[model samples]
Every structure is written in C-alpha cells, then in structure tokens.
Target: MRSSRSWRLVVEAFPLLILCIGCGPASTASPTAKPATTASTAAAVASVEPDVPVAQPEPIAEPVDSPSAVIEPVAPQPVFRPDDPREPQDDAQLAELGIRVYESRRLKLYTDIDSDAARTLPGYVDQLYDALEAYFGPLPPDRNGTDFQMTGYLLKDERLFREAGLIPLDLPPINHGRHRANEFWMREQLYDYYRRHLLFHEVTHCFMTFVPDTQTPVWYLEGMAEHFGTHRIQADGRLSFGVMPTSPDEAAGWGRVTLIREAFADGHPRTLADVFALQPADFLMNDAYGWSWSACHFLATHPRYRERFEQLGRDGRGPRFIRRLTELFEPDGRDLATEWALYVVNLQYGYDCGRAAIDFQRGSTLTAETPARTVMIEPTRGWQSTQVLLEQGQEYTITATGEITLADEPKPWVSGPRGISIRYAEGHPLGQLLACLRAEEATAAETMLRILPIGEGRTFAAPITGTLYLRINDSWSELADNRGEFSVTITRAD
Candidate 1:
C-alpha cells in the first residue's frame, strides 16, 4: 500500500471534484451518436452524467462574399508527443472527433466515455506514478530532466478509435488490454474498479520499459504488474495503490483471490517453483495470473524474503536476472518452500504475513535427561515451534490445555482445545488444535507440511523425522481477531 499522505497533492489540486473537461472545437456531427455512446458505455459514466444533453455540432460557415477581405490562415494545433516519441497526434483534432483527452504529470488518457467516469482518474494515475516511483525508484529523467509520460487509450468504442486512426492497424487485437513502449490500449471494462485496474496493469508495463536491456522473466514481469495494479480507493476519495483487497465488496470483478483459493481447493496449487517456471503462453488463462500474483506477493511482503526480493527491482535487470534471483534464495530455499506451502494453504483476503511467519529453530531430540518440552502456542499466530524433534517410527504423546477467545464482536466466544463445532476450517473444527511436521529436507509445497488434529491430547508415531509445530486452527484472514494462547507439552511415549 502507498504512504499515508500519498494522495495529498492530488487531493489539494482536485478538492471536491477533479474532472477537468478540456476546451476544444465543438463537434460538427449530429448529437444522436453522443446519446447512444452514453447509453452503451460503462455504468460509471452514466451515473456521473445521468441527464446531461449532448451538444449539437457547430454549423459550417458559408463561404464569405469577400474572400480576400481578411482571411488569416488558422495555425494548426501543436502535436502532442507521447513518451515513445515515435508517433504524435494533434490533441484538438482528437477532441473534435468526440474523444476527450485528459493529462497529468505522467499520463495522457484519451477516451470517448462521459466526463463523469473520467473524474479524478488523471490524478489517480499521477498517484500511481508516485507509487511506482516509491517501489522501483525514480525513473531516470530525459536529457532535459523531464519525467516520462505515457499515452493511453481507454476505449468505449473500438470502431471509433480505429476510424480516427488512433489505434495502429498493425496492433494485435486485445481482449482486455495491451501495452507497448509508452502507449497502452484497453477496452472499457464491465466495472469501474476493474477498468482502472486493467489501466494500471498496462501502465505498469509501460513504466518498466525504462529498465534497459532487461530480459526479465515473464513471471516477474506480469507478477509485478499484478502486484502494483491491485489498488483501493477510499470512500473519501483518498487513493491507495498496491493494496490487498479486504473483501469482495471493495474490489468488485477483481477475483485473483478467488482464483487462488479455488485452484488450491481443487488440489492443483502452484508451488513457488511452478510459478517461476510459468511461460508466456501460460498467461493466456487467468489461473496463471493468480499464481504469479501469489508468488510475488508472498516474496515481496514476507519479512524474511522481502529485502532480497526488493533487490530484484534494483539488480534484476539484464539476461542474468532469473539466475541472480535463484541464487539469492537458494540458501533458504527449503524453508521458503515450506512457508510458501503454509501460506497457500491458508491464503485468503487480508492475509497477515507477520502473524503467519514461522520461527524455524532446529529442535533437540528427546533424551533420558531431557524428556519433555512445552511450548506456548498463540491463537493469533499461524504456527509455533515446540523445539522437540521426533524420530521416525517413534511414538510421542501431545497434550494441550488452555482457553482462547476466538472473537469479541457480538460477544467473546471462548473455546478450549476442542474448539467450536459451528464453523470449520480446512475440514477441521474452528479453533481446534492442529499439528504439523516440518522436515528439513522437505522442499515440495504440496507435501512439506501435513496437518493433523491434536485436540486436548493425542499419541501417535512420528510420520517422519522432523520438528513439531502447532497452532490453533482458524481462518487465515481472521487471525487478527483472535486472543489468548495454548500451553502444549510434548514427550516421548512408550
């Protein structure tokens, strides 16, 4: 997410409302098309300008009787240059053809939608620029020290843009959005938030073009776009970029979380390596986007890996980008894989990385002098280490005692080790005590941790030699609302 005051400058500039309509030559065509355009466009625009009547085109002036009386030739409007510097267009001409143009410090948006939907969008893009700069460092300025700016076509009618020569003939047909150099094109989306999301996603691609000679992997490229494109706009009009959506209501039509949960539930969860190996063709389906986003979000936000992950932005250019990234995590690769598995298993909206982080301390084996170990397992945390390593084929007895407050909203709902019966997570009772073995050599996400129910007491032979980790089973997204802890004791059994 962006800093607290990231939108201060934008808010000051566009207080109350920010839709700045451009002044241009009035349309010379019939007003019938404008009504149809509004009716067929996204609902956001219609809500903004519900009943505004379209203006009739200006009438052509009759030829003057005295042609030579005083006919000063009108100077043509200056060509607007996008960041690419390859093709420029006359801004006034585009506006005259029913396209409304919006400009900011970093973007020039041309669209045929009503002005209401365009409100505060330019400022929002400017805010996005600030966020991109915050994450990837400031982009290098041109020779004159001017910041880069891009051109975007947010199209409501593809035919209109094609007829106006705005869309290149050679440009490939896009279902949603595409970007090249400093220009991007996207069709109007069904929802307003999704429309902005696709816009930011493409704009992120344009921003990354500054990295010279970058042969960055396809996963990183698209993942980074997805990472930066997820955003939230507060009810007060404050804008925040790169945020995880807390609920479905807040981010309508953005279903990355749902896709991930469904994929994992179907037993096809993509491991970190699986995500890394994804090819460009894999992105033709939406599932690839979900997996890529999960991997990037995990590495970028997790405390242990975030520092090294952020270095990818600074040192991740050139053909050796993937090689360098692999080398960076190779040391902790096993632990990372285990943690990633845990993350995916519990993935949900508003996932808290700090609470889910596992403290990996190698455990000492049970001995004659040291027989048992007790660990405090917190309800607000994902997993806690017991510092006791069990041997393969050896039996161990586990006992936990304590009460915990699962929630305090309507009233404090307390539960013992047995947990509540009304709700369940991962097919287990909510707030039930759960156990898992984390072997040092286990690197595959699918088999790294096998959770077993251990409510109150249980005696079982070790499935494999590994450290013992325990937790109060609960929804990953709802961990923050929980309170209290459990006292769990482990001892070797005869």
Candidate 2:
C-alpha cells in the first residue's frame, strides 16, 4: 500500500519558492471527540493538516543606493523534516486508554487487541527487519549512529487508538495499511497470517524510505513488498519471506494466486509491460497487487533473470530506475514476455519456479534427408522444445513410449503414455503427453499455448507455423513428484 501522504524535505533557505502539495493544517480539535466510522475517519484524516508549519513569504529589501536604506524583517521559514521525532506518548496514559505496548529489538508496537498474536507482533517485526536487511542490505544508522527502529500501531479498535492520540489526524486514511518514514499503521485483519503479511508489507515501505533518491516505480515498490510480505513462518518459529505457499491453509486470506488465475481465466491477464505500467491509483484495487507480485516473483526467482533482478534492488532508487531496468532486460525482452505469460497462465499454489523455467530453442524445418526427429520429454519439467519447426497447413505424426511415476504418496502410481484416468489436470489425464505450437516471435498476449493432447500417437494438421513444445499433462504445482521421460518422435506426414 502507498503512503497516504508523500514525505518531503522542505529547504529552509527557499521556503517561499517551494510548494508542498497535500500538506494540511494541524488539528486543534480534541482527540476525545466521538470517533467516526472507518470510512468517515479516513475522509477526515485526509483533510487534516500535518504538524509542519506553513511556508511564509519573504520580505523585500529596499535598494542599497537609496538615501534611507531599510530592510523589512523576514518571516520565519517553515522547515519540514520527515525524520523529526514524534512527541512521546506517556505509557501510563496509553495503558489507561487500553493500548498495549510491545517492544523488541527493532519495533515498538502498540495495539488494542488482547490476543497472543498482537503481543508477539514486535518479535515478528524484528524477524521481518532481518529478512529485509538480508534482501536489501543493512540500512544505514541515523546521523548519530543510533540503531534504526520503527513504531507501529495495529488498530483493533480505531477509537481506542484515536483516544490515545496515537492515530495522527494528518495521516491519510487507508483501507488496510499505510506507512511513513519509520512508522506505520494497520487495521485489524481477520486472519493471523494476513495480519502478519500486512505488518511485513508496511514495514517494507518503512525500509524503502531509508534508501535515498529512489523514485522507484509503483509496480516494483508494491510488487517487491508483496513478494516479501507473502511469507511463511516455519515450525521452529523462523519467518521465511518470498515463499511459494504450498496450500491455502498455509496462507489463509492471501488470494494472490487465486486472483492471477481468475484474471487469466477471464481473459484479462496482464502482460509484463502492463504490470510495469501500473499507476499508484491502479493499486486501490486488489488485482494490481496480484499482477505486480507475479512479475516481481517471476523475475526474482527465475534462474535466467535472478542475478539481474537482484542488481535492480541496489540501483533501483533513481529516477531512471525503470529505464535502466528496461535496458537491463532489453536483450531478452521477447523471452521475458513469453515466459511471463506462461508463468501467470500456469500459476498455482506451490508453483515450481526452477522446474518450470522454459529453455527456448529455435527449431529447424524438416527436409528429405531427415523426415523425422526424436526428442526426450521429461515429466519433471515444463514445455520442453521439440526442436522441429512446423509449417502452417502441414500434417504431422507424433508417437511416444513412456512409463512414469506420477506420485508416491499412498502407493507409487505408474502410468504409460496414455496417462491414468484416476487423476487429471487441465481437463486431461495426468501423465499424458501434451503439445503446443509457439510462434518464433510470439508475445505474451499472443503466446497462449493451446493444449493438444497427443498421448501415445496422433496425426494432426498444424494450425499455425511454429515450433513444437511438449510437456506431460500434470498440475503445474505437482511436477516435483513426477519421474521418468518419454522418447517421442515427430514426423512430417507426406
């Protein structure tokens, strides 16, 4: 989520020339006033002025050559510093207002929820700090070299926080979460997993503020935050960030995977460029978050782009960050788009990034000297190239011989070329062979691989001239348990 107010540093020397948008007047109303509903409160908060003093016009000086030179007194310049320390709230007064304070190494959390999760949020935030440090490098200490720390409010009841004077009147109202500088605020979430998820997401924003000069694109800012926020706590209480959740049970209330799948099914799938072009306003909807996360996740995890993607973290804080990013992947731009399309279309819980990484290879046209070509198809991987280009309107014959283990759970289930019917995926029997023709220069929008089930043997006419790519019909999430390979041959039928 984007911050409600954009943080800016006002130069005292040029106060009259600088104009700060979205700056409001400080509130004089009593905090004890009856609290408004969430929506109404957000509207009120958005209009309230921040505590910063308003800029005043400078006085003009009389000409030095005049007989009686006079200079008017200059108005005091309004200075704005985002890092200025907030007024300390008395713990005793906070306790009286039913606000519980929890502190750890990096986080000082205040919440009204009496649940154990709320009590443990500070520690969880500390773990999230470590994770961020690991990913983005350690944040520099303050000018005085003091260790960095953050303050957050997890609001179970907004009224309690408001009454305690913890919720700033100038804070922009948010639907779920918001962050500024080293502080953040979040409303109570229904699920513990999602609660932590949001906490981590807001903390990511806080961390990014420490990085200087970053005009990072909205897609990346939100996407990387969503990437890190999508995490799993291990049995040992260790927090793991950027995890591919194996099931909905592990990531309850997180619908990123579901959102992507639904979009693809609805024929509204976003391409890599589409995701990159997302504006801050687009993020008000949930679908923007899903697409953003997918793009970041794919680039960050894919073997082909991981190194370059990581480099982006270090150098992605400038105005030219997006242009640099585009240039960095310019060489593989086509492949990037094609692969991204495949990734979203096959996205699911427990997606196997390594196994599903496609290796695009150009194919040669068949000739009289070589009428047929054979290739080995692995069930453990996705869409292996057959290296045989097909011409439009030409008929081809395909045959396969294979026996593979689809699973080993209850009992090892073995299947031949014509996959077992007991289990199915993509409306076809699991372990069955599937084929699709992809044009040499197909784009994400044009790269939807239509499934052609060619179990043991089949003869079919090519709908379009393109390279043949094959894979075993199975769940994109369940490829790990697959074993063995199929020896397949493709021949140009005369």
Report the number of the highest-lDDT candidate.
2
TM-score of 1: 0.80
Off by over 4 Å in 1: 1-83, 443-448
Per-candidate TM-score against the hidden true structure: 0.80, 0.82
What digit string (tens of lDDT, one per residue) describes model 1 on residues 1-494? 11224223211221121111110111112322111111111221101111111112234455567958765565543222223454777889988888888988888899998888875677888888888878877665554556688889989988879988988775656456766667778877666777787788878877776544434666677778888778888788767876777765556566777667777777888767678777554555666667777888888888888889888777766545655565577667667767887788778778888789888887779977878888889999888888889888999999989999998878888988988998898789988999988774653333436788999999999988888888898887788989888889999976
Residue lDDT tens for model 2, 98-158: 8878999888888888758787788888888888887777765444556678898888889
Give the CA lDDT, 0 to 100, for residue 183 in model 1. Answer: 76
lDDT of 2: 0.73
RMSD of each: 16.6, 10.7
- Residue pairs with colliding backbones in model 1 are none
The ten-residue window of minimal lDDT in model 1 covers 18-27
